[model samples]
Target: MRDPVDKLSAMAIFARVVERGSFSAVAREMQISQPTISKVVKALETELGGKLIARSTRQLSLTDEGLRYYAECRQILAAVDAAEHSFQSGKERIAGHLRIGSSVSFGRLQIAPRLAEFLKRYPDIDIDLQLNDQNQDLIREGLDVTFRIGELNDSGLIARQIGITHRVTVAAPDYLRQHGQPQSPAELSAHNCLQFNLLNSQNLWVFENNNKRHEVRIKGSAQSNNSEAIREMVLGGLGIALSPVWLFSEDLKAGRVTAILSDYVAQSLPIHAVSPANRRQSARVKAFVDYMSQALDAAPELKPVR
Candidate 1:
């Protein structure tokens, strides 16, 4: 090992001497000769061009300059210790705040429930989860990460596909019994289709057949910006809705809602984790996203939304 002869070492030694009120005590603690500790303190005072210590046969006291230098040295030493702790290990490193944005239904039913386990694994991490159906500007909103449905637009943000989600056209048994079930995508035009107002075009529903794409622009009796609201309206026998399968998983299992358009399926979109380009480098954001990905994969209702 090399000798601790640097200026920082000298400053630290001087601070320790001041803290202990004895050069001999600091020398014994550092496993160095008392004369060597005195030499290091003298060198430190010379370099700073200040008289740092007032010494007597009984004890030592810091001069005004020494008091200021000791305070500054404590700050420097604390910063060095913090830097070391931050990179020492994963548990120590991933300690910080994480601001996450996600859609309402997905956040509550998917991400929020699984966060308990994530927090258990990273007790040092604090999560701030904001849920809304509307799109968010990650950088402008000061969000560390966000979950977005569908293909991401080209922008400064970094995006990665985390899972697959698809829409299912469903109606309550009462609603279908009253209005009659639509046999084809085009027939949906004649039905009272509930709309998710958060979508850019609530009237347009796209479908695929024979590897060809087609669209149906239909009217609706009720609409809501929130997925849960639209889901509730559908359950009340108000209208049909194209919704995420997981949102209606319980109803589907109980046979309260019936899925339609078996021949022409609604397209599946990739759910994504979007972050500011700079935030993509953050260990907290990456760890959170990775945990969310695993949790989503294990969700029985989600099932990749195929």
Candidate 2:
């Protein structure tokens, strides 16, 4: 019989195998032979006295016991990582891979442009920036941090409010000239409104003026899940859009688009740097979030209009 193995190491390997969904993939990641990886997991199962993984030619799956064990393993591993991270000193602690997520337009316009300077400051760090319109599971995607716009729905995340997305109702000059400017919130119904379908209330627009509120349900010729696409539609003179002020700040200055409904206030969304609550925040993640918060605070377009 084989002597007792390092159970913590074996548990980590098992977790990675399940996370990657392939034994070969985990083996390649750890730079170990595939058989050795399999043996480690098998040994872990043997010691635990139950099957952890069911393997086939196509994929790997967890049994009921494995699922529960895997969940506990993740929490324990994260705690270990956090404990180790706490011991490293100063800038030395901030060295590692950071996986970041954000919406396409925000990532492109705000985060991507600032990365060069951030990289220059922390040369030891590497970043993987993933931009998508859909709000996918951050833990499943292995994201260390994500920039979320609007009110957060995921109670499982720990969020820090980094900025405000001050919204505006805007249209291209050509569109306004053709459709006429909407003088009041109620008049928006007479115009073509572009909707960003990702929001729950995409078709419903709310405005406030002098303690009075107006809710308008609008219809349009176009609807897109992406904010960039909505911006494009507004630029093409197809319709008016209610979007973040940063989205069209340059366009507003350049006369490409005009901000209407000045008498009323469009709802502003909060920008948050979110992380999985179960995982402890690493130094790199904290550093990045702090840098982003400071950078965004200085941005004029993200500031709330008084």
Candidate 3:
């Protein structure tokens, strides 16, 4: 039988060396001699029957075998840590790491502010938030949950629809006065349309009129991948923009921008909390989703745009 102490020591040292990229760094961190770290690594490689790392005087790199081994080792270590944490916390409270993925605007304007409240309610839970406009692969990235603002296209993931987000065409009063307002979707072609480049149909603005939906292809002088930047530009009277009403409700209400094409409204996109189907019942995952759902329901700023 293998010695548990030796196995743990080997795993710990391996992880440290991989992270630090050198045996000397691990030795300095552990306050042990460099030779001792090397010995442990060599022993681990022998036990596993694979050369996990290629070491040199200048640099270190993992072999293909090492990369695969490290991936498995990391997962195993995380599971062990979670198990220990669960035992210590008595399973009554939400604990361990909860990684969340969300779009930049929604994450910043809505989700992030409520994070402190969540922490206060569940002190044991640690949150790691990743905010970007790009859609990420949740399972591959090891995310516990994600906030998606539009239609979910991934068939394998489970999505819980929390609320709906309306789309609107908005522009500064100055821009509308200077350039003239668009009375119909066709007239939008003559105006400077500020486009959000991340959307699947970036050039097309969808509008609904009397139960009929119309998609108008719009040309824009200004375009950006960042949604916040687009909103800022629109607020500054650079051009008209099509975006979710929730993103610009404050601006709309404060008279910074006016909603146009009011007669031809767009359909509301459902906001969803998505996760891998397999982890739908996970305690930490469920806790976060529930917390966010409640927080959103109570937030006055998230009210539907009329």
**TM-score versus the correct structure, for each prediction:** 0.69, 0.85, 0.75
Clashes of 3: 0
Q: State how far residue 50 of model 1 sits from its true place (Å).
A: 34
Off by over 4 Å in 1: 1-85, 89-92, 304-306
Query: Candidate 1, which ten residues in sequence have the lowest lDDT sum?
Result: 76-85
Q: Give one digit per residue, the lDDT tens place, for model 1 in 104-123.
A: 88899888888898999988
Global local distance difference test of model 3: 0.82
Q: Candidate 2's residue-wise lDDT over 230-299, tens digit each? A: 9999999999999999899888889999999988999878899999886778888999999999999998
Candidates in order have lDDT scores of 0.80, 0.87, 0.82
Q: Looking at candidate 2, what is the lDDT of residue 252?
A: 85
Give candidate 2 misplaced runs (Cα > 4 Å): 1-13, 20-47, 54-61, 79-92, 304-306
**Which candidate, 2 or 3, has the higher lDDT?**
2
| Model 1 alpha-carbon miss at residue 223, Å | 1.4
Best candidate, lDDT-wise? 2
lDDT tens per residue, model 3, 1-306: 199767866886787688677888888868999999999999999998989999788998999999887767666665665556555346634677788999999999888988898889888888899898889777545577899887777988898988667678899999999999998888998989998887777898888889888878898788998889999899888999988777888898899999888899865677899986644345677888888888777766566456
Q: What ranking emerges by TM-score with the best candidate at the front?
A: 2, 3, 1
Candidate 2 C-alpha error for residue 18, in Å:
3.8
